[model samples]
Target: MSAVPAGSPVRTGAVVPVLASAGITVALMQTLVIPVIPELPRLLNASAGATAWAITATLLAAAVATPIMGRLGDMYGKRRMLLISIGLLVAGSIVAALSSSLVPLIVGRALQGFAAGVIPLGISIMRDELPSDRLGTATAQMSASLGVGGALGLPAAALLAENISWHALFWVSAGLGVIILGLVLRFVPESSVRSGGRFDVLGGVGLSFGLISLLLAISQGADWGWTSAPTLGLFAVAVVTILAWGWWERRTSEPLVDLRTTARPQVLLTNLASMVFGFAMFAMSLVVPQLLQMPKATGFGLGQSMLASGLVMGPSGLVMLLTAPLSAKISAARGPKATLMLGAIVVAAGYGVGSILMGSVWEIVLVSLLIGAGIGLAYGAMPALIMSAVPVSETAAANSFNTLMRSIGTSVSSAVAGVILANLTINLGTHTLPSQTGFRTVLIIGAAAALVALAIAACIPTRSPTPTPPATPASAEAPATA
Candidate 1:
């Protein structure tokens, strides 16, 4: 594996769009089943608890697979791993579309989750292939694709679920995946940059177990009793496994993740900032839709249909896409640290405003746009920060780890919001709903999380010094050393 010549000619117009489109296609998996969640028990002829696995399986699989796929991409080829990931997504969609029961649906969702590595891999590809002039906006667009797909998927999925069979959702996903796969094969070049090494099998297993235990506890703690044996047991296992995994990583010759490199202040602080920003960003996704769909009798509720709520939220995704260029400009001019801090401030302000303006649909849309802009700026800057701090060979792995941090943050955010909403519910004719106070409390927490991210970002170096590769046998196998 050797580095692509820096001077290799790239068709920027074709490469960027293909990669970004692929990224969006992968991201659409996250929200693809949301519209069918409430109806899952009836549709699948299973308990709600079993049906929830359809969503949980995806989250757990994604968390476990992201870092592993990234390492594989580095060792083999980014484009190859990327293609495999997209293939899994397509296969998953087809399986899900064809499934008539809960078990196969969960399996398909888990397979779909394997595509989580696509965005980070796309960013790495951009770094390897794009000219410096095009890199910033290109990565920005790729990063924003996550939000773009998620926001857009909600409305699209809602329309399909409303008008046709719920299975149509997966069928459409499979169709889109096929189209994206073809475009990727045609347009995206395999990066010559590679970190050739044996995969760390034990390290990967350790990480997967730890992450699975931790996320399972967080995501399911609300439904399971918070203090139940299962929740506590999973949390304990996660802590012990992660601690032991860290010990192993520190000593392993060719570790899965180079903990030494990750411990660098620039990398460490940027990752910390990413986590809190993820926490802040997810609050809107959890809160606004509920506010929209709650019955009008709830006083603050707007009483909108799921489709209408999705339509209102839809603009926020477009805002993210539209702001990518602006985010890139800010990062290029002031450094990614500044861009991240600015984004945090904007998000905090958005939440602050949202805490006050829960009265109407238009106000919710305004809040959604504000937060989306902030998340767009923050998300766009993260890859720049991570790539700047890590060696080229470690690019995908570092970015994937950063993404895992954000995922952890969102899981925790969901747990915390669930607890608050559950505890502070108002009764409305045999139904329990989150009170205005609960929503406001969640908004305030979101604002506080954004400020915490800003504080963490402030600690990141204004410019990361070029990192030296970790002292491992694998370092010699990297294109830089080769």
Candidate 2:
């Protein structure tokens, strides 16, 4: 592999936008079915628990495939893997659009999940192609696309669900996928850098099993009875499998994850903080919409429709988009560590304010904007932090692993929030709803998570960690100068 010639043109102007659009498209899939989740059981003629698999399948598949696809992106070609990912998204959307029942929908969703690598891969591509000065903001925007798409997609999805068949949602997803795929092919360039190596088939299998078992336990624990044999058994299997996987990863010459690189204090602490930030970030998503849509009769409920709630939440994503560049500027001047800390502090403050000011729609909107800004800032800094500490060859895999940590955190937050809300419910006439106390408690916990992330970010070294030697590429000699 060789670098592009010094005089060769790089169409960076086109690359960043295309990659970012690719990222936003993949993210839309995550929220595409959210508006239809409650109606799923009736629509699909399946039990509620069975229909829930529509969501779980995507989670499990994303968790399992993100890292593996990322590794392939590094080894083969980032652009190549990215195209394959979008292709899967298109295929999944079409399959889902055609499905009238549970099984195919779940399968389609799992395939959509396989595209979760797109964002990290896009970040990696930006690193490989963008000018150094352009890299931070480009990656920041790409990172924020997750929230941007989720926030923006909700109202559109709600509208579609209200006026159009639910299947229309998948059709739209497929249509967008096709457009993004064409744009990527036309504008994005395959990187010359490659970490050529045989795929770690065994490690991938082990990690997949471990993640699936762990997430299944966490996601289903409440319904399964937290202490039930199935939940405990899955937890046990997860712990053992992850431990064995770690052992094997440490020993394998060509590993699925380079543990040595991952264990560096900078990388380790960033991942820990990412998980905590993820918990804090998701806490808002869980609390706000419910607060907005709750019946006004409960004394606290706002009684808004799903579309109204989504519209109210829409500005938060806009704030995130607007804040991404500022985050990059902060990272440039003060360091990514400072940006991360600032973001955490803002998040904590947002939740703290949310706890006190839950009385009106305006107050909730303010809270959403504050937290969205915080998440944008934090998310922008993460790739810089990871890239600074990792070898160029390992960029996608390392970033993918960080993304996985965040996903894990959100999963745990969802489970914990569900338990808190389920156990602390108030009866409104004939309906049971999460009590104001439960929502308050979740907000408090969200603030606590932000504070924890802040503390963890504080522990990160003031200086970048000394990077380990770049791994030997299986197909080519090491670069003469790095």
Candidate 3:
């Protein structure tokens, strides 16, 4: 294996496509169920709050799984872990499809959520398999696709659900999962790099509990009064557990996360920016559909159907797909920091535009395009920044950490948006707009978050060099021969 040069074309042909498809699969599973949320009350004979758990359950599962799986991949093998995650998605889809009750559906969604690990795994694999010259573009494209998949999946799922049954969405996802599994088996080569350490079962358990406790509190706090014992106790446990987990990681020989490298200013700031961008981007995903599909009698709404509302968000994903390569080019020229700053400024501007003009469906769509472009630019830069700062050995872990941060941002934002929309009321005589005031408040929050990210980007020292190529074993051996 050492005889093969790192940049040798042998691996690129097989690896790149597989990694890209893996990313698409991740997005498909994550977003496919979103369109079904509004319909869940009728489908499962549940209340509105209970139905929302389908989305929340998936988020919770993915948040906990991403970092653990990334660490596992680093310790064992990326290809093996990728296969495991895809398999889990398939099983989850099947379970979801077969379910007649909300419990089964939530279980299935939780299972499928594990697939979120695929993004960080693919990004890490790209770092490992691709040459330095090619790495930037490949990672950028993969990172951008997360937004693209989300953008595209909403319409695809909405159209399917509207035309057929909601169960069809899961059926379609299962079919896609099978295809992704085959692709991985055929094209993705196993990594030779392995860490000879046992899995830290205790540490993983502690981390999972900590995250679950924290997320549970944040997500449920609005429904259950913040003063409630369950909410307060969960928050307290989360703080203590997370602190304990950090100490354990510092001492463990095979820690679940490498805290030292993650603590670096570059990696730390990049992750923070990712969280903010994630929060800002999710505002569109959460609010736009509500604004569009809401009954016109509600005064502030356009009364678009679910399918049409989803279609509005689809173009943003398309824009993200188109803008990714451009983002890579900008990062290559002006550096990732500049690209991130530019993206944040664009996001803030997009929200500002949204605040003024979101009364119509087309205006919402137009703002989505701007938001998608901003996400494409900013999301692409985050992984590049992280990969640059950490050792190759730490790529998966670092990327996973960054991915986790984005999830955190999205979860926090989703909960906050829920609160804002719930508290504000709009009354327009015969018809009351659900609450234009709430929408405005969330948009303002998003705009401010984007500005904070921009400020952080400015603070990131521009002196750090672009990532350099790793020396292949072949190159090292060549010197001996000479």
Q: Per model, state how many residue pairs clash.
A: 0, 0, 1
Model 1 is weakest, by summed lDDT over 10 consecutive residues, at 464-473
Candidate 1, residues 308-373: lDDT per residue as tens digits? 998999999999988888888888888888888998999999999999999998899999999999
lDDT of 2 by residue, 222-301 (tens): 99999999999999999999999999999999999999989988889999999999999999889998999999999999
Worst 10 residues of 2 by lDDT: 473-482
Question: What TM-score fits each model?
Answer: 0.95, 0.95, 0.93
Q: Which runs of model 2 end up more than 4 angstroms from their true locations? A: 1-8, 464-482
Residue-level lDDT for 470 in candidate 1: 24
Winner on TM-score (2 vs 3): 2
lDDT of 3 at 167: 92
Clashing pairs in 3: 298-432
Tens-place lDDT digits, model 3, residues 276-379 = 88898889888888889877777678988877887898889878867877787888888889989999999999998998887887789889999888988888
lDDT of 3 at 464: 47
Q: lDDT of all the models against the reference?
A: 0.88, 0.88, 0.82
